[model samples]
Target: MTSPPPHVAVSNYKGGVGKTSLAQGLTVAAAEAGDRVLVIDMDAQGNLTRRLRAPLSPNPDERFGASLADVLQRPAKGEIERILVPCGYGGIYSERISVAPTHFDLELLARTAGQAASERRLLRALAGVTDDFDLVVIDTPPRLFCHLIDIAWTASDVILMPCEGEYEAVEAARRVKERVLEDRHTLNPDLEIAGMVVSRYRSNLTLHKQRAKEMEKIVGAEGICPTRLPELVAFKNMSEKALPIVECGSEGRHMASLYRDVYKWSRDRINTVMKGAA
Candidate 1:
C-alpha cells in the first residue's frame, strides 16, 4: 500500500499578509503537540527559513544538497534527511521543529523548468520523505510563480489560504480557490481546500469585521476557522526573536492560546478529511 501524502501548503496571492506567520504557527503548534513537523520554505525571500534560524549555504549554485532548490532540481536521487535542519529557540519548553531550507536562488528553478515540471518539483521532492513527518507545512511565495504553481499541484493535500480582513484579500482568496480547482482537476486529484483562515482581525475596526463576514459568505462558514488571530504586538515580537509565541511567556500567552485553537481545528480537519476519504 502507498503511504499518505504528508504536505500542506499555505498560500496567498497578496503580499504583506500573514502567510509566513501562519505557516510558522502551524508548524510550531503541531510540533509542540507531539507531531513531528517539517516545514518547506518555498518562498525565495527566505523569511520562514530565517525566522526559524535554519542554516543556508553561502554558495547558491550547489546541487542536490541542503537547499530546497537543489533538492527540487534532483529530488529523486537526493536524500531528504541531509536537507532538514533542526530549528528551535533556546528555552526549557522550546519545541523541536525541522525545516528544508531554501534560498532566493530557488526562483531560478521555476524559471528553468517548463510549467508542468516547475509545478511538480515540490511534490516530487516531498515524495522522497513523506513518512518522516506527521505533517509537512509549505510556505509559498505571494505571486502565482512557477514554484507556487508546483506547490498547488503536487505538494498540497490541503490548501490553507489566509486572508487579511480586507476586500482585496477576499478576492485574492477566490482567485487562489480557482487555481486550486484547476490544480485538483489536472495534477493532484486528491487535493482539497482545508479552510480559509481570517488573520490580523481587529474588533475595534468596523471594516475588519465587516470584510470578515463578507469573506465567510464567499467561502462558506465550514471553511472559516473559529479562532481569529488578533493583531498583536507579540506576533511581531516573536518573529523578531525567531520563536513561536508559545515559547515566550506572559507577553505571548494569549497568542499562543490562539495558535492552540488553530492547531486543534486543523487536527480535527485532518482527521475528518482522512476518514471521509477512507
Candidate 2:
C-alpha cells in the first residue's frame, strides 16, 4: 500500500467558526497550484459534503458510490477510493479536487468510533488509496473529546486550528489544544499543531479583539494568523452559492488574495511538520 499524503485536519472543535470554509480554501489553494487534493468530510452534519454537492462525476475513469461512513465502518478495504466524488465547483480546478462525502446518518458511527480499534480506522482506510493526491484535508466535526475526533486527529499529520473571535470559540480551541497535548503523549506523537486562524473577526468589537488576543496567547503571537477574516456578506454569499472565493470572479479573486499568504503559510507548516516526522 502507498503511504497517504500529509493529512491536515482543519478544526477548532467550535461550531460556526469557518472550519469548513478554511478546508475549502485550502483545497482551492492546492488545486490552483495544480495539485491533486482529496477532501474528506468527517462532520456528521455533512455541511462540507452538501456544500460541495457531491456524487457528481469527477472524471470519466472512476465513479463515486460511497460515503465517508462507508470508508470507516464498512469492512471493504477499497471503500476509501470508491467514495471520492468530485467537488461541486467545476471551474479550472475541476480535475484537481475530489471529495468524500457524508450525511446526518454518519452520526451513527459514533458508537463504533468508541471502540478501541476505531482510532486507526481512518488511517487503515487511507492506506490503500491516498497515493493519487498531493495532500488530504479533513474537515473535522465540532464535537470534542469524542472517538470521531480522536480517530481523525490520530490520522492527521498536522492540526490546523480555525476559530472565531468569540469567548466560546477561544474556550473550545483551548480544549482542543489540551487534547492535542494528550495526543502527542499518546496516540500520535508526531501530530503537530500548525497554528490558529481567527475568522469572522470584528475589529470594532472589543470582545472580538480580546478573544483574538487570547487566541494569540494560546498559539503564541507568531502562531496566530494575521489575516483575521471579518464578518462579511461576501463570505456568506460565496458559501451559499457553494463557491470558493477564488472562483467568484474578480471580487472573489481579490478576496482570495487576502488569504493567499495565510494558506501558503499553513501549507508550509503542514509540510514542515510532516517532514520533521519523516
lDDT of 1 by residue, 1-278 (tens): 55654477898888767999998888877877877777888888889998888867675455335687777766673355678878755432234577888877777775656554556666666665767567878898887545555654476777787888988888888887787676566667777777777898988999988888877775578778889888888888777788878767775888888887897897677656655655
Model 2 scores a C-alpha lDDT of: 0.77
Please report, as a residue range, the 10-residue window in candidate 2 with the lowest summed lDDT.
Answer: 56-65
Question: CA lDDT of each candidate?
Answer: 0.75, 0.77
Worst 10 residues of 1 by lDDT: 88-97
Best candidate (score: TM-score) = 1
Q: How close to the true structure is residue 104 of candidate 1, measured as C-alpha lDDT?
A: 74
> What local lDDT does model 2 show for residue 121?
80
Cα lDDT for residue 210, model 2? 88
